[model samples]
Target: MRELLRSAVAAGACALLAGALAPATAFADPTVTIEGYSTDVRAEAVSALVAERGLGTASAEALLRTQEAATSALDAALAQLGDSAAGGYLDESGAPVVNVVNESAATSVEGVTTRLVTRTTAELESARDELEALPQVSHTAIAVDPVTNQVVVTVGEAVIGAAGTAGLLAAAERMGDTVRIEHVAGGFEPAIYGGEAITGGGSRCSAGFNVNSGGQDYIVDAGHCTAAVSQWNVGPSVDASFPGDDYGLIRNDTGSAPGAVSLYDGSVQEIASASDAHVGQSICKSGSTTGLTCGTVEATNVTVNYPQGAVHELVQTSASAGSGDSGGALFAGSVGLGITSGMGEDSSFFQPLTEALGAYGVRLN
Candidate 1:
């Protein structure tokens, strides 16, 4: 089965700690408190999957197993790709699928299934470069969907009618079906809110996770949000990376940032540690507007072109979240998942917590 470390209840959901892998925050400020994601939130998502994706409980459990088994090996899988293996993911059928360039690489692994693809990842990367060069390509995101063995380009409907869009479409056409274009109704934007109510800048953003860097307590969030304001509900902005990356670190001067995520239902989940997300893994998002929503990771290493600029290395999931959710917590049970970055009705994306931690030299509180 897929494995990180061990397994345990995340918040109250059936989900496991990203690894089975919390603490009480010293709250001197009454406004600063930890909220947990509700157990019902996961129930809702699972129900939707049953109704919409023909998903069953058995399928869900199987997917979780495959996810645990493959996660640790995924990095090695990529490293050892023999010009054939494009990538891998778990399918709705609860089958672990991997893309291979040749038959020799198609052998079944412990928890994996395989498929053959004609194009190599390098070739898809070249197509992506071509698409990125187009001027009308704003409001779009692209990633390699290993399940489909193709480069999927998601665009906002607003750009569908733009004159420059034609060039993008032409590039996709030239790719001979290797490039798939999908349209989203609302264009993607950073969901930063007026931070004032949350003890942040006028722009609002959800607190990602409480972290400690070099013995300093801080709250992690979207750089775009942090770039706009210097103070958070509990403290001041100390370190951040934006434009280049999308995380901001706020120093806790008065109180400690909690090692938990709000459930919005008056509970909090302990964050054991930070971890990277994988395609097909079930994930939950905690945002101010939408609260907590869960879905499976549909894509990884996604690059989003928001109105503000481009943000890369995002994890794309089927979970739906919106406005004022920027820098919100994205987690799996007890494992620290991600920080909310952007979203659409059908999909949402996050900046992985592992990267955020590494970039800021921090660890989960």
Candidate 2:
């Protein structure tokens, strides 16, 4: 994987920084063709799909095309359906599945499969808010699961017998079946250190994306990492937001870098644009620790309460990530999606890229 480009003249300082800095090198020349998917599909991502989903190369390419189509269709459907649209996701065959509150609402959305559900997205979000108002506890996460038409609360095994968990469980029970509690081993934490990529403050985090605003360049990353490390090997921290939101920006002093992510497989995936991720959309994450991992979006509008603080409006995915993967790229094909934030027991969480870009007033480079 390509480390953050640094100035070679700072060799002495680089040595002093040791593990926190690496000698700078040029990024690989951007390549377009990868396994006959033209420039749209990444080879490493295709391999991941083949291995994880047990699909052939041709089948994986077709799925990628389908996912791209579903993304566009979902965007239009959501805009047209408005509040009546419960939620939308991609099915197992990469087809768009939209949930509507009633038959009338269903008729408004076309070019996608629509299912009538009992609850609207607004209702489920209200339930999530109620759960968040409860006594905040560690090792727990709350998210709206559109597939089940309920709010899912994930409690870590470490807190199952703890006092705080009892109150949480009681509240969930009182809420009835609208709240689903699932147990898993281990707690959620920001992925920092223990991997090689972007480094500062003796910690390592993956660089998210190269962005620009007002002719100035910056790199977006996990807020928790930027909050702790003011200076990075590439540049200094410019802005950061943690606790409620996990996103930050670092000044990019090394001139313009390509709008692409390293696949850690001797190639890179060119990022063409940015978009919001929908539930069930096939996506991939590139991190220093795990390289490139692929999976579907499990949930959106998620709230993960880490030991540090509660992070809201996160997207949960089945993609795998670990320490040092914080601030890595979460994308689908050439479209940018999110910045790696943390990991739960069985799922990974990301800060939505659209929100970060809007907050920073930066556009993809």
Candidate 3:
């Protein structure tokens, strides 16, 4: 009786194995999916049998049910292939892995996306902090014309109300204490405007530039410089504008001489037509306060408001600016960015080169 029962069991197992190996007429394609997205190709069913067996019985049983269903479907597809030798099964420990040739591979997207977002956020925050630490000012000033299209930042006691001077001080205080500030006493040389010594106890003033309006010349300088100058020393040939209009010209030079525009330390660039500026150009500057500095044009036609008033329509650049650096020049290497008008930390502002030309009528070299 026992032998008969054993023989019957063997026959049943053999019949089931034969059914699984039987060839079918239609060979259905396997679907590959990653992150819920489907791919058009064949795929093999792989079961992950963890040796640790840390999962509870209920979870393990659920996993087993899923594995069996996937395996049965894969087997059905394989049987229809017609060629039994093309694919086979792989055994890793007790886990049965079905290997299907020419299967489409899917990428692990969730892990990659998480990493990219984390890195981008970190980089943006770092850049913002760096920008906020740069030098900036709260002062305002008028633009005077010494040569053509130049701005001046008064220093010393006159710097109290001087537009360019006040703006410079505000920017400087933002920087670290490593930088030192000083003033050039006893006037050096007058270039565009007329003055013996600017920033003195008497009618104090600093250098500036001239914008050629038609045939006339209009002086531009740091608006703050005018507050320091109690009386106008401009010439018989020059007219004046202030506060709302930061542009003016040399109308007189009685005992004093007309100021010129300084280029480098002691060098100067001849003013031609002030309309020779374009986007993406380079520029250099020289100032009684900051001396000479160079940078590139960042933008044009920028308007900025200050405590004194608002100066509209100016140029901007990445040029480094500090106290006394206001009313300088923004140049394209040899070209010009206009004149140093205002600054924010490391960034500096300039009057429009075209505006200067339109206001005065002089050419920029």
User: In terms of lDDT, which candidate is strongest?
Assistant: 2
Candidate 1, 117-152: lDDT as tens digits: 888778877887777777735678888888777889
lDDT of each: 0.67, 0.76, 0.35
lDDT score of residue 108 within candidate 2 = 71
Q: TM-score, each model?
A: 0.82, 0.87, 0.38
Cα miss at 95, model 1 (Å)?
Answer: 4.2
Q: Model 3, 305: alpha-carbon shift in Å? A: 2.1
Worst 10 residues of 3 by lDDT: 11-20
lDDT of each residue in 35-131, candidate 2, tens digit only: 3232423554556566667777677667776777778998899889989898888776678888999899878767999999888788888887887
Off by over 4 Å in 2: 1-41, 50-57, 194-200
lDDT tens digits, residues 110-138, model 3? 11101111112223223323322333222
Model 1 stretches astray by more than 4 angstroms: 1-45, 58-62, 73-76, 93-95, 108-110, 160-163, 194-200
Model 1 lDDT, full chain set: 0.67
